[model samples]
Every structure is written in C-alpha cells, then in structure tokens.
Target chain A: MQLALGPLLYCWPREQVLSFYEQAAGWPVEIVYLGEVVCSKRRVLSLDEWLDLAKHLESAGKQVVLSTLTLLEAGSELGALRRLCRNGHFDVEANDMAAVNILAAAGVEFIGGPTLNIYNPRTLAVLVGQGLRRWVLPFELSHPAASELINAAPASCTCEVFAWGRLPLSWSARCYTARAENRAKDQCEIICRNDPDGRLVSTREGQPFLTINGVQMQSALTQDLAPWIPEMEAAGIQVLRLSPQYSGMDEVVECFDRLRRDPGDQEVLRRLQSLAAVGVCDGYWHGEAGFANTANGLQQS
Target chain B: MQRMKLVCPAGNLPSLRAAVDGGADAVYLGFRDATNARHFAGLNFSRDSIQQGVQYAHGHGCKVFVAINTYPQPQGWTQWQRAVDEAADLGADALILADTGLLDYATRRWPDVARHLSVQASATNPEALSFYHRLFDIRRAVLPRVLSLRQVARLIEHSPVPVEVFGFGSLCVMAEGRCLLSSYVTGRSPNTYGACSPASHVRWEETDQGLESRLNEVLIDRYGPGEQAGYPTICKGRFRVGEHVYYAMEEPTSLNTLDILPELMRAGVAAIKVEGRQRSPAYVAQVTAVMRAAIDACLADPQAYKPHAAWQQALASVSEGTQTTLGAYHRPWL
Candidate 1:
C-alpha cells in the first residue's frame, strides 16, 4: 500500500505552506495532493503557486495531484476548476460534480475525491466510464461497505481511504468561522487564519465536539486508521490518504510508514495518539458513531 | 406568463390529498423506507398508498413525483431498484433521483418514465446539470439551496434542462447529499438512511437550567425559560467557540422565498418546491395554499407583485423558529 498526503483543508500563511511542502518532499509519502479543498477565498497560495509547488514536489520524487474546491459557488470558482482540469501537468482530484463534469468533458483522467459520493459500484462504473482512474472512499463508509465497493469496483479504478486527520464532516454555504466572529460571509475579514488548524467548537457540557474551518465543519477527533492497515489491505484499498495538519505531520507520515513496515508496533500507535490534536477515533471504520474511539474498545452509540 | 408549477411534499395519503386539493400543481413523495430522504417512522408511503396517491393526484390534474434520492449502499441497490420499478408500475408522473446508478437503472429499465434529479444530487452549476441531463435524459433538476439569485440566473441561462428551486420550508444550512454531521453524532444520515438527526437518537431532558436537546448524547442546544425551541438539527445548534457561545453555524429558522417569487419567475425557474414531508397534512395544506396564491399572484402581475401579509402570517405559523429568511437567495446570508 502507498501513503498519499491529502490536500491541506485549512488556511495557512504562504511561507508556512511552502515550507511544509519543501519538508514533505523528503517524507515517506509517495503521492502529495496540493491545493485547497476548503473555502475558495483562501488565496494565500494561488493556483499558479500551487502548480509551482507541485513542480517542486514532482522533482523530489513525489507524485502530485491538484485537488479542486469541494463546493463550487460562483462562475469564478468553476473557472478556477476549468483551469485546474486543463492544467495539463498534474492529475486533478475531482471533489465536486462540477469538477467531474469539467474533467470528463475535457477528456482528462482524474481521481475522484471523497466528497464525490461514489457509494455504490454502479456510480463507480459510471465514473470509471468518464475516465476516473482512482477514487478516495467517502469518510462515512464502514469496513463492509468499503470492502463491497472495492470488490465490485472496476479493476482499473484504484481505491484510496482517508487514513488520518480530522474527518471533514460537512460543508455549508455559511462560513462558520466568519459567523463565529459575528461577520457575514461576504463582508468578513479572512479571520480563519487565526486558527490555522481550525477553531474548536465544544458542546455546552464542554466536550470537544467539532472544529469550524471556514465553511467546513470537521470532527474534533483526528481519524487514525494506522492500526487498521491490515484491514484496509484486506479490503483491497491500495492508497492510504493522510490529510495534512498544521503540526506534527512529519511524525504522522513516519508513524504510518513504520506501521506498514512493522504491522504490530504498539509504540508507533502510542506516538500517533500523542500527536493527534484531540486524541484519535476509528469508529466510522467500525460502523459506529464517528466520534467514538473504537481503538480503545470504547464503543459509544 | 407561464404559471410556474407548485410542487409540494406528501408524507402520507392525507397529505397527498391535501396537497392536490390545496392547489399544488404537483406533489412529490417517497416510499416508506431508506429509499427517500425523509425516512421517518410512521411517515412516507406504502405501495398501496402510492397507487392511491397517483390516482388522487391525477384526478385533480396534479402530477406525482416519487423521490428515491438516497445513495444506495453496494449491497442494497436492489431495494432502490425495486422502488424505481414499483413507482413506474404505479404510473407515477416522474422519479426524483440523486444516485447516478439509480438514474441509470431507471432510465434504462423504464424509458418512458420521466426523471427529475433530486436536490440531494447537489448539482449547483450548469455543467453538473448538463452532465446529469446528458447521461440520464433527466427532464428537470432541483437546484440545491445554496445558490444566490444571480448564480441561479446564470445557471438557468446555461442549463440544458429546466430547473426547480426550493420555495419554502425547513432549511438545510449544509448542502444536501454531502453533509455527514448527522451520522457523525448519530449512526444514521441522509445519504445512507435518508434521515438527518433521526428522532430515534434524540433525547429531550428538562434540567434546572433549561430544556436541553441532545442528539446521541451530544447537547445540541439548551433552551431558556419561555424560549421557543426548534428541532435540534446540528447546524442550528449553539456551540462554544473560543470565548463566545452562539449559533456557530446557523440559527433555527426556515427558508421563505415568497418575496422572491417575481425574481424566480424572471429567472425562468420551471417549478417551485415546498420542502416538508415529515409534517402534518394540515401543514402541507396550509403551505401549499399560501405558496399557490403567492405564485399565481406573482405570475399574474410581475410588476405589481407583493407577498401578502396574510400569506406570510400563515407560513410563519407552520415555520420552525416562527421566523423565515430568504436563505442563500439573499447575498448577505452567504
């Protein structure tokens, strides 16, 4: 199985993003997904800048893929998607249907992003007919569902699973970060940069509930599937996608690399748990509530 | 001026009759299973009820659209396929679908049956709409409730087929078919089970401070004394972010596009959808009546169109939070 760095879902400073990629070039990850999949207003790195970074990562022996916006609202967003699809250098990860349509119309082979919602084999076959080369499984799919989908999927289409990072639970037109700051989406300042990883939203009882990253709502707990590598392999998943966090990503990459080399390493799992922003969860993989930490044998329904 | 079609929801036989009698040009419903987005207990239709609904609607010069919008799991495609075949056998006017596989199956197996893309497909742009229309030969596509008026107009100009927009009812702040927040808190979701924030997992507790609404043990909101409580959808819940506690996503409210009927007419929207199937027959009747009046008045005289105060009052009585906004149609809401 190959480790692929998923796109950065948070807003970061330009220098930090560049330096992170430069550092990531030396990591054990074979594939790197560059570009923003969250809010389109996050222009700290322009499309050209992302393409330039992709070139840098490619020279460092990393297979690069440009990820498209998850929600395309405006003509400008669709225009950006068209450019990404026609970039002609890196393969594009089609996150939304618009991206899929554009890529298919352009006769470009693309990787289906998790948000594309390919749940059944028939949807997979339709996408495969439209030149889909690889598909990242949606975060909510359980072990049995993923296994069934992989087994039924067209042989040419590869499967990737989100193995690490906070699960992106949902996306909305209303920007939660801007709303939290008491500003409308249009008139708001770029305040999401304040919380590089994303602002934590806690329940009234003060439990870590969710994270607000601009328009995207993510789980407070990072989904760690490292312990389930064998299960994923058994399910016929070829690529493990690790979403980039603001910190401790190198350690995360190394831990997954070490796990693939030595399957039953308790020390590596412990180190991975320590680096998670809000501990770890593997419940969705086990068909339980996504917030439940099934790895510790605690199954809360 | 073309009289815009008023599509309303019918959760049961009574609601189906009520919608047709209350001036609905058409009524959309789902079978009583995971095949539809409103898969609630004691709600939706059985095969007998759907056959009766089709006869009743057709008698009243109204059309019946069956919504089989949920994405089917790999092992469960047969259930959805059976639903499409049954709806077709029942002589329904159209099949409202979201899944590409279901659409493919429906179009191939029942070529003469009309197909409408459900809002759950989340096809916001003309390109996405074009793709669905080209592949499945869909007659109409329901626009997701996330587009601004101008964006809707632009899409209409480029669309390959006629479009439908949500005219009123409970608002989903997140894009439909894409949100997993419900499953994150509970085990059920709209995509997988056709229900979001399922009532089976909900608990209402009365505490010393207030009435708390919890979904799967996560406190969605706490209502103070005399505070009107809406349904505890996770998006409308209050949460603490940094030093402040507020409706971090959206406040409990409904979407009312009564005031924008003229603009929607100008945008060439073919149909206006009223969105509440998990409601009472009375709720369906009242909403369909007001929306019918509003649409007729707007189409009759676009220049002098004005939303009646009585119509607004009638809708507010049934609206959650006792208030309504234009939602994403208004630019500031975005």
Candidate 2:
C-alpha cells in the first residue's frame, strides 16, 4: 500500500509547518495533502506559501492535493474555497459539499475528503459521477465496511483509509483549543499552536482520552493499523493515510515503511508499540467501537 | 405578517407525540438508526413508530419532517438511502439532509420529497445556500447557530431557499456539522453517529477538588460545589491557558431566542427551529408548548408581548443551567 500524508490539523508556526513539509519531502509517502483543515483564522502559511510547498513536494515525487477548510463560515471562507478550486496546480480535497460544488462547477477532479461522509457504494458512485478520483473513508467506518466499499469503488476511484494517527472526529466554528486556554475565538492569539500533538484531556481517574486541536477534536490515542496491513491489502485498500502529529512522525513513517516492505512480519506490532503514542486502536476497522485495538491480539469485550 | 413555523425536536415516539400534541406546528424526528443526528440510545423513532407518527401529526394538522441528516458512510449508505426512501414512502413532509452525496441521492431518488438542509451542512452564506438549492432543489436551509442577525439577513436576501433559524436548544458554541470534539473523545460524532457528548464517554467524580466530569478517561471539567459544570468535551472543559482556567470553548448555555423573536421575524426568516432531540418527552412538550404560545403572542402583538417570564423560567429549568446566551445571533464574534 502507498503512504499518504494527511493535512496538518494542528496550528503551527509558519517555520515549523515549512520545516515539517521540508522533512516530509524525503518520507516514503506518495501523496501529501496540504492546507488548513481546521480553523481559517490561522495564517501560519498563506495560500501562496502552501502552493509553493506543493510544487516542492511534487518535484520530490509526491502527489499533492490542497485541502479546503472543513467548516466554511463566511464569505471569506467561500472565497478561499473558490481559490483552491481555481489553483490549477494540484488536485483539491473537497471536505464539504460547498467545496465539492465549487470543484464540480469548475470541472475540477477532486478527492472526496473523509469529511464528505461517503457511506456506501451508491454514494461513492454518485461522487464518482461528480468527478471523484479518490475517496478517504470517514474515521468511524469499520474495516469490513471499508473493504466492501473499496471493492465497490468505480473503476476510476482510489480508496484510501485513515489508517494511522489520532482520528479527527469533528470540526466546529467555535475554537475549543482557544477555549481551553480561556480565550474567545477572535482573541485566541493562535494559542492552539502551543499544543503540537493537541492538548490531551484526561478523565478524573487520569485516563488518557481526547485531545483538543483548535476547532477540531481528536482522540488522545494515535490510531495505528500497522498490524492490519495484511487485512488492508486483502481488502484492496490502495492507500493508507498517516496524519501528521506534533512529533516522532519520521520514526512513525520509517516503522510503516518497514512493515510495507514485509507485510507478513509478525514482529511489526512489537516494534510499533515502542514508537506510537499512548494507545493504539483499530476498532473502527474491525466494525467495533473506534477505541477497540485489534492489533493487540485481544478482541474487545 | 404570517406566523413562522415552529419546528421542534422529538427524540422518540413519546417526544414526537408530545411535541405534536404540545402545539408544535411541525415535529421533526429521525429513525433509531444512524441516518439521523440524535442517535443516542432510547431516543429517535423506529420504522413502525415513524409511520404512526406521520399519521398522528397529519391527524392533528401538524407536519412531520424526518431527519435523515447524518453523513452517510460509503459502506453504510444503504441505511441512510433506505431511510429517505422509506420516509418518502411513509408520506413524511420533508427530509433534513447534510451530506452532499446523500443530498444528491435524495434529490435524484425522491424528487417529490421536500428537502430541508440540516445545520450539519454548515451552509452559512448565500452562495452555499444557492448551491444546495440549485443542486438538490432544497426548499429550506437550517441556518447554523454561528450566524449573526445581519449575516442571516444577508443570507435571506441572496439565498434561493427559505431560511430556518434555531430559536432554542443546546447551543453548539462551535459551528454545527463541522465539530468533531464529541467523536474525538467518545469515538462518536454528531455528523457520523448522530451523537454529541455521548453518555457512554461521560463520567463524573466527587473528589476533594469537587465534582469532575470526564470523557474517554479525560477530566474535561471540574466543578466546585456551587459552580455549575457543563457537559464534558475537551473544549468545553475548564483548562489552564497560561494562568486562566475557565470554560474555553463554551460555558454550557442553551439558546433562548424568545427575546429576539421580533428580530428574526423582521429578518424574513421563514421558520424557527428548537434543538433538543435527545431531551425527555416532558422537556419537548414543555419547551414546544411555551415557544408555540410565545410565537403566537409575539405575532399577534409584538408591542404588547413581553418575553414571558414563565417561559424563561421553564426553559431554564430544563436547560444546561447557570449560563444562557443568545448565541451567535447577538454576537459580534461567534
């Protein structure tokens, strides 16, 4: 399976974002989705800078796609979506229907972003009719469902699953990350950049649970399907997306590279355990609750 | 001016029946499955109940809108699609939709069915509204709570479809259709699973620090004996930013737009929506009845009608408690 690097969900300094992409140039991933998928207030990297980086990544042999804001609030966000549709240099990942309509009206072939919520073969066919080239499975869809959908994708569509990283479960217009810092969204001061892996939320019992990433909420556990490589391949998944985290992504990519090289390697899970953050879950893949980890050889009770 | 329709939520058959009987002009509900946004257990309608509900609402001269609003997963589109087909077959007046693919499917599969855009679509502008209207032939759009009155006015001016505004319910401080906070913590999203701050992920503890509310093993809120605790979500929880610990995302507020009824009506809004789908049947009946009377009184005489103190008190009793904001309708920045 090919590796696809997802758009950076967390807000980062412009320098940090540039440096992250700079390092990603040499990573084994084949596709890199650039642009903000969360809040639009963040001006870490302007559209021009993102396009410039897209060129660099493309030159380094990676296919690039510009992602639209998951939540389009005002006229300005719609204008940005229009610009992304007109960018011309790379494919667009339509996160919302407005983006899809923008792309379809312009006759731009786009990847159906995970947030598009494609649930069955018929919806896939509908999007494909509307010019869908590739589609990412929503975070909550199980592996069996994904397998069925992948097998059912139209001839022209590529099926990619968010195989690794903390699943981005939702996006909102309200800035939770800023709220976590006791600030209004307008005066958030880009405080979300401080928590690179997202601010971890713990239960009263000190159980690691969720993470706050600005307007987006994610799982505290980095979901990994490294051990499920055999099943994914068997299921006909073309690409496995690994979302960028705050740190240790290079090591994470390297670990995935090794697994791709030897899909049958029994010790991949043991090696991955040392590298992944706190918890590992592939429950959504197994058609169970998302937190259930099928990799540990233990079925969820 | 004609009285705007008061569309209220009915999580289950009892709430559905209560909302219709409680004087709602129309009651909107979803099936027990994932097709609707309120997918909490013991909530939402079953197939037989939905059919019965349509008949009951029609008998009462009330309309029924089935919310097949959740985003359909690629592998699970069958349930959502079938729900829409069944809703159409059952003679439901409308279907509240969010996903583009599903919207396209509903429009193509059931051209005769009326389509109301769910808040989950987050279509806040004229262009977005027009796009949905042109593509899906959507008759109405539920304005996201993030819009101010001016924005809503502008939208109504340019929108090809009629606008529906949230008059009351749980105020999603964050934009609806876009928030993933609940899914991040509980592994269930309102967009994907029709659940927000699901109960399975929530737990409260009384400790030396006071009452702590937790989700997915994370301490999202800590309440002193007197301080009211909001629902648990990473953003809604009290956290330290530099030196301040407060409700960062939202301070647990319910939207009470009763006072602003005149403003929304003046803005040419076509309908007023109330937001509780997971609340009790009694809560639905009380809120709907109060709002129905409040709207009627306002339309009959805006100059003499004061925001009912009793309505406010009853709403407060069922609300999240401690905090209430007009939400984005009055906000300069939402």
Candidate 3:
C-alpha cells in the first residue's frame, strides 16, 4: 500500500533534475530511485551529484536508491557502475547483471530493477541469496503472472510493480533518437535532450506506437494500473512504483496516493486517464497485448 | 592457441545432422516445446528425435548442446525442469540456459553436465559473465549482439569461462533477453514464449500502398513490390519519427563477422556461433559450411587472413538482408 517513485529515464537538464528532486522531497512517496537508467551518455547528474541529491533526499525523510544504467557497454560505464555499487550510503538498484554481480560480491543488499528479468521464483530466490532485498516486477508481467512469482518468492523479499508511466519496452545498442535524426551514435549531438519525454514514433498510418529515448523504446501511451489497485493489494504487493515523467508526475503520484486510500475513487481515475500521454493501457496486466487497455474502462486509442 | 569451436544451430534432426556433417564442432538445438528460446511450429526436436541427434553427433565426434533458455513460468515451471532432466538424460554435451532459477536447478541436480549461458541471459560485461560462472559453473557463455569488438575482447580477457560470439545470422538490434517490443505488439515475447514476433500473429495484407506486414493487427512494415522484405519483427520495421519514416531502430540485416574473424580469434574467443535455429536445414547447412571455412582460414594464419569474396557472396545469398555488417562488434556500429 506504499508508493515509490521509480528512476528518471529521460535526459533532463541539470536544473530541471535538481528542481524535480527538490520538489519530490515533499511528495507523499516514501522511497525515491534516482540516477540515469537509460543512456550512460546522460551526465546531467554525475554519480557525485546523484549522491549529493541522495543525501539531501535522505534528510527529507525519504529512503533513496541509486539506479544503474540499463545497458552497460563501455568500461567507463562499468567504472561509473562500480562507484554506484560502492556508494556505501544508499542501496543500489541493479539494472544489469554486472551491477548485480558487483553488489552481490560486495555483499550489499540491493533492490532488483525491472530489467533484471526476475520471471520465476528460483531467479528471485537465487537473487535473494545473493543479497536481493526487493525487486520491481518487469514491465511485461501480467497481473496473474506477477501474483504467481510474488507468491513463490521468499517471504522476506518484497515485490514492487510499475504502477504508472510509459512502459520501457526494450533496450538497444543503437540509439534510435540519434538514428531518427540521421546521426551516428558517436559525433552526434546529444539530441535526446530536445525531447524530454522521448520522441513519439507512430505507425505509417500515423497511429502512435512507441516513444524513442536514446536506446530505450517505450510505449507511446501511459500505463495506469491504479484501477487494479485492489488486485495488487489482494496479491500482497507491498509497493507500487510510479515512474517519473516530465510533466504531471507529481499529479500521477497524488492520484495513486488518493486511490490507495479509497480504491473506489472514480474521479481520480478519470483525471489519471486525462494525464495519459496519448491513451491509457493496462493490457500487459490483462494478459493481452501490452498496448491494449479495456479492463479499467480506459480507452486504448 | 586452440582452434575456436564453431557452434551451429539446428531446429530439427535434419538440421542437427546438417550442422554436424557441415563441420560444426558443436550443434545447439532446443526441444519442440517452450523450454527453449526458438520455440516455433514445425521446429525444434522432440525427445526421441533429440536422442537420435545426440547419437549421430556423438558418433561424428561432434557435441550437441540442448538449449533450455527461456524463463520458466509458474504454470510451466515443471515442464522446463523436466526438459533439463530430459536433455541430461539424452547425453547433451551442454545445456545452454538463460534462466537463473533453471540454472540453479540444473546445477544442483546434474552438477556433472556442462552448462553454457545462452545469449538470452544478455550478460554483456566481464562482471556479469563472472557472476554466471560463479553461480552456475557455466563452461561457456555466448555474448549478446550488443557488445563491440573491443568490449568482447576485453570481456574475454577477464572472463572466468570461454566466450562465444555470433558469427553470422539475422541481426538483433536490441539486447536479446531484455527486449519486450515483441510482446507489446504480439503479446508473446522471447523470454515468455520463446518467440519474437510469433508467426501465429503475423498477417500479410496487400493494399494500395503495397504489401504490408502486420503482427496482431499492428502494421509492422510496408514493402514495395520488388523490395526484398525480411522477417516482420518490430525492431527491423520502418516507422515514423518526427515527419520521417525509416528504419529508426535497425534495418533487416545479418551480423557477418567473417571480416573480423581474425580479430575475434586473436582476441581469444573460445567459439564462433551461427545464430538461426528457426531457419531451415539448408540455412543451417550453408551458414555452418561457410563459417567453418571462415574460422579455419582465420586460425591458419591470423596475420594474413582475409575474408574471401566468395564467402561473402555465399553468405549474402542466405542472409536476411541484402548485405551484412559486423553489427555491434565494430565501434562505429553503436
């Protein structure tokens, strides 16, 4: 029944990232994940700077977790990850297995990021043995699928589900944002900064399909599982993670906060749908196409 | 240095025989169920057929690797476990696994059998390989397609186990295990269903614009009449981004590492892999034969090895794209 803010996936300006965290200090969420989880090229917030923000957020009475990059390519990125794992102040969310290995070797208890792909209990159990404290259910897991794994997971290990935001569907070595601009990954300007929430990629028929943010591809529509709040509770999900979007992030957090207090809050759901980047989808939860959303009465289009 | 092992993929018994007869040091295949990554209709081996394949490969002094790479779900957990037992019983030389839990089970029950990490695990760096090696005692690890040549060389230098890199096949622009673009459109992903852009959901429609490929009613791409269309996966398809329509992710192509075989061999890669288990026996035979020659040429004279034009032409004819690139192996590919 607790709310947590997931890592920021976009490449925002330094001032915007700082101001967002400063405002987040007063938000109702108890836990906040901060760091660059998309492209390692995003250095708007350095590890030292992220640690400074973590210290400030900790003072603001919030538990902080440092998130690692989803795709680790260069040795320099590995060096950055080594620093994150050895931060010693806050727990780290291991996004890739290299981070997991470093944290486990250091004997540091860490949160498993969604990209770790903890699909089965044995995977969770193996991670639990290797110092996994909690795990974020991967974005693709359906409601029943999540429940099965959560049930089979060790009793002490907690489960967190991505409650609201654009679903991060895939990661590639090639940067689509750069490719879309007809630029090479090297020698190209950091053009991703131009689109804060990611550039929208639509079908040839002009239907929104996905959003490209550097190497990550996300669903064009927002995924809101607030309508299934009761089901998550019934399945013993300890926390619901709300990913940080450029706009309306605080409102998304507030709506979830209100809905948790009153599961039947109809007005809150209506406002949440309006906040959808294009439309709302909870289809992955329904065991249907990830872009389909019908159970919550949210329009798929 | 020892000659690098050449691993070829086989979907059926015929493909397995083709790989072995075509000079594959090891032939990797999956059961005809969801236990492996390449779960497709009329593909993969049944228990009896795999037993026959093992006998054939073993008799030919070749190794057979059984792939149980997909993450096992709650409902199908026991099925995956049983597949591990079956592959072991069939005398598989190694088990190419991606799931940690399944690796845990296989490690505990059949500690003697060699376990190779499947590329579906997407363990890109040296530390990740170390983790898998430390935990599962995996003997070999197939590197994901996302690493550069320098990255792959650096990893091999520090890896606890021998490393395998893809030599030729249809290219995967994304990290293998982590991508879910297929599930978003078709509701079946590589991790969950062992199929990306499952053929069941694919539909080809001819419209005014030309031929269009749709997955679960979502238009993936449109092809001109003379355009040689490849497979209908989301990443390789053309889409619109800010008034532009093109292959924003990746073009349909193959990862031809023949040009860089000497570099990979010199870097101490343990094996060269040909990735196309879902393809035909002919595709397997052609790739295995060409790669066998390429690896041998590189090993014979690392300083003077040059990829022959004939080898390139032979590979291009069977490639998914008209041409091939070194893929993420080259620094500029990223």
Candidate 4:
C-alpha cells in the first residue's frame, strides 16, 4: 500500500546526514522515520538539527516519525528519550517498552517499533489501547505468521512490514563497531562513520554473513519482497519499510515505487534481483532457515 | 535478614539434584519445548520430570522456577500457555517469562503464582523494570549481564521488585532477550524458538591455521595451534578490519564472578545466577558449591572472604576456553 523509509541505522557525518535526508525528501515514500536507532554514542547532529530535518521532511509532504534508541544504557540515554517524547514536533517510534512508558506518560501517540516484539493480536490490541497507531512486524515473522496476526489486528491500528534492506537482527549495549575499531566504548571517536554500508563481516570461506552497524548487527542479505507483493497485500500489510544503505538507495526506492505503481512487473523484480548488495533472501518469510533462498520456484510456499 | 538466593540452571534431572545439593536456594529449568529458551536435545525437563524435580527441590527446602520465556507463535501460543498452566499446577516456585504479552497472560491467568522476568526481556534499567511492576506484577527481574556494578546498584535503588544478577557463567556479549543473530544466521532465535548457537548448526574443522568453529557453515572463530577454541556464536567470533584481524566480539572466555562477591552483595542483588544449563552435573555441583561458600563467607565478613584457589582451579577445568573474566561487572565497556 505505502512505502516507509526506516531511520538511518549507520552513523554518518553531519553534512552527510543532512544531505541524505535532503535527497530522501524527493523519494516516493509515504513515511520517513528519522533519528539514530543504533548506538547513542554516535551524535554527528544535535537534537535540534534532527528536529529541523524532521520539519523539512514534513514540509516535503512526507509523514515524519522520530525513533528512539533500541538499547537504553545510561541516564543520558533516558534523558534523551524524555526530550524526544516532549519535543511535540512529530510522532515517535517507541523501540523499547521504556520508550512506550515514557510516551504514554507524556500523553503522546507513537508507532510501535519492531523491537517491541508484538507477536499476537492481543498484544497489538493492548498497544493500541496505549495510543499505538501503527505496528511494524519483526523480521523473524514469516508470511503465514504475519497473516495470522494481521488478520486479527484491531481496526484502529495499521500494520507495517520490514520488506527491504538488511534485517536488523540484534542490538547490544557494547558497541561492536567501536570494539572492531580497537577503541573503548566511551572514548571511541566516531568509528561507525568509517563504513557507510556498515562493516561487512564474512565467514572464513569468504561468504557474506552479517553487517555490523555500531551495536546493532544486521543480515548481510537485503530482504526483497517484490516477488511477494501480492502475498503481502493479501496479508494486509499497510506499509513496507526500506532501510537506508550507502549506495544505490535512490534506485532501490525507485524500483520499489515502480512496482508499487504497477504490480506484477517482472522486469522490476528482475532488476531488484540484480541490484541488491549481498543479493536477496526471502527464506525467513517462508518459515525456513533465514539464509535459505528459494528464489527459483523450486521450494514449496 | 534473609540470605540472598542462589538460583542455578538445571537442564536435566542430575543437574537439578546437583544444584539443590550444592546449596542452591532455587533451581530454574524449562520443559522440553519451544516454551523454554534452552530447547536442546537430551536437555531440559519433560512435564513428568518437572513435577518430580519440583517435588525433589521442595523436599530439600529449595525452590524450582519454570522458564517459559520464549515468545509464543500464533498457532503455538496454546502450547506455551499450557506450559504456564502446567508449571503452576506442578507447584513451581515461580515462572520466568520474557514476552510482555505472555507475562500479561500468565499474571491474569494464574494470579497467585510468583512471576519473575527472564533476562531475555532485557529490562535493564529502573524505568524498564517498572513496566513489569505496573502491568504484569513481576516479582523479580533477572537482569541482562550488560550492566556495570554501579549501574546495577542505581537500578536496585529504584526497582520495586527484587534484582537478580549473573554471578558466573557464559556472558552473552549481546543484550539478552533481544538477540536474533543466531536466528538470522540459522532459523531459530532464543526469543522465538528457544535456541542460540544451536548444536545442529555447529561444526568443527581442522584447518591449516588450527581448529575452526563454525555455525551453519559460517566460520565464527578460528583457533591457532595450542590455543583453545570456543563454540561458534556469531557475536563471539574473531574478524578483520583493515588487514588487522582479531576477536571482534570477545576473546574466547567465560564469566568468573567469585572475586566480585562483595560488590554484588553491597549492591543488594537479591539473587546471583550461574548460567550453564548445558553443562555437566559435576560442573554444576562444583560451581554451585563454590558460590554457596563464597556467599556465606561474604555474609560473615565482607572483607575477609578469600576465594579458595581450588575453586578457581575447579572452575577452569570446565570453562569454555580456559580463560575467564569479570565480564561487564568491572569493565562496562569491554
């Protein structure tokens, strides 16, 4: 139905961060989730600057939502969450239950992020009671599982799916990006910016495995649902989230937008197959091993 | 004053008995299903075994907590719900749960049963911990092993429920309860399917460099000649950046908290957990007894408790890679 650009998980310089959103304003996307969702130590732009960018995105006819940190560690982190709740500029995507409480206490309506792990319909109803307007399905939910949950979704809530980009698998308090740079977590000088697409971690045999974006680790394979748009529609998916990567991001948005405009576009699907960085994987959607790819119609759905 | 509780893991009946005999105030375990987080072959309790184990623990003045922690699938919710009802009916001391929805269900369904929040919930701070109190009425919170002693103390000062911290065992580098790395590489997550670095995905190879440990055909870590190799979990593997390769996630080691008993006691941690459910009964007996003695000595004289060298020696005999550290307790950034 609609496309949502997920918040930038990787750290970028201030100019790069500003420039990226400036370009993103023109993309054919409905919702744009901004702010840092990975490590809180990465602060290339101040809170004020993020708000300014949110205002700019809103001006460009895109719905804006601010995202809080996935893992809250210290007092400073909680304080930032409070500020975001009280900012009153745009809605917030509550990544953790702590943020959910903060937003509920502040009397702010928010979108429930994927990390909240709302698996069942009753949980969705409860969150909706707490002023949750939208819910993003966690990456591990297969098509059959998501369809069951979506069928039971409350009429008041909208359901979104993580349809593209590397699946965010986990988050840690300890920064792996900092550790990889041979620096301590506290004193590490902004090392995550060194790799825009995240540091590609491979197996010993040179197979692409995972990408590390600060404390958050993601699958190396980009999840492409172009071939399953009909299935997603049947499952009542309202929005498809595309995560921000370093290169060919605009082309990614365009390819998906073209498919959205005209469903069953084989050329676009074939184009998506060739454009992904680490190739495409849809196995988790089929309830198989996450790395198992059944792209050639050889496996049963 | 009530002595702090020592909760230990028991994957099987033998370890359950060993834990109780070694002075564990309570032994926690899961049934043989996805409802439990440690669903390995030949491990965890069956429904019958849990009833027997609870009876055994209760007879010894010890408690048993059933861990029905993983999230319930759509069609699979009935199975997990049955575990909660059965664990409660079997007279378990408490139920350790992680999913918020499941916690809510258990609290409403079995109001009289004591409920503890599993570490997989990742409720690290006072604000997060308070959510369980306000909603599900969780009696205690098993904290993730990522907090520093000072942070833990601050949280204890604010928590309405009892706090439990890891005393010794395999320290998860990633945040507990939230990790999907294993599921991303394989298909099962500790939260969704009750497995991580699952045995089925593991493979060991004799490489030219040394021993290579892999998970799902992916090289997690490589050991040099004479260097001990640890099990391959993606987070604890060695990797390279700019031609400099090393242990990117963590050095091959386990957690040792015998030296930090004083700090944990001073911080008012209600329970100290030892985390190896897959370990041998001998390892459980030896580790639990050593910790029990250490806690007693610390209570008698906080400054006078000198951990015996033999305990550390015994610990090293069953360690993951023959090296251990006070993981995240002393060094929050390591």
DockQ of 2: 0.32
lDDT, candidate 2, B1-334, per-residue tens: 3568899898877888898888899899988877888888888787898888898899999999989888876656777889988999999999998887788888988999899999888787776677788778999999888777777877787778888999988887666776666655566778778887788888998988898887766678788877876767555566543344555456677888888887788888889999998889999998998999999987888778788788888888888764467877775335
Instruction: Give stretches of model 3 more than 4 Å off.
Output: A296-301
Every candidate's chain B TM-score? 0.99, 0.95, 0.98, 0.96
Question: Where in model 1 is the C-alpha error above 4 Å?
Answer: A297-301
Error of 3 at A274 (Å): 0.7
Q: Chain B TM-score of model 4, please?
A: 0.96
Tens digits of lDDT, candidate 1, A1-301: 9999999989888899989999999999999999989888988888888998999999999999999998878888888889888998799999987888888888999999998899898998889989899999988989999999888887888999999999999887889888888888897678898888999999888989999999999999999988899999988999999999999999999999999988678888888888998778888899888887878842221
Compose the digit string of candidate 4's lDDT tens values, residues A108-214. Answer: 78899998888777677667767898989877889988988888877668888888888888777677788877778777787888889888877655777788788
Give the higher-TM-score candidate: 2 or 4. Answer: 4
Error of 2 at A62 (Å): 2.4
- Per-residue accuracy of model 3 over A30-120 as CA lDDT, tens digit each: 9999999998887887788999999999999999999998888788888999999999879999999899999988989999999888888
Docking class of 4: medium
**Which scores higher on TM-score, 3 or 4?**
3
Error of 3 at B146 (Å): 0.6
Q: Write the per-residue lDDT of candidate 3 for residues B1-334, one digit (tens) a residue.
A: 6679899999998988999999999999999888888889999898899999999999999999999999887788899999999999999999999999999999999999999999999898888888898999999999889988888888888889999989999888889999899998877899999999999999998999999999888888999989987779999888998888998788888889988888898899999989999989999898888888888887889898998889899899998877899988886877
Give every collision pair in model 3.
none
**Each prediction's TM-score versus the true structure:** 0.98, 0.88, 0.98, 0.96
lDDT of 4: 0.84
Q: What DockQ does predicted model 1 obtain? A: 0.78
For model 2, residues A208-284, the per-residue Cα lDDT tens digits are: 66677887767777788888888888888889898888788887788888888896665655666656577787777
RMSD of each: 1.6, 3.6, 1.3, 2.2
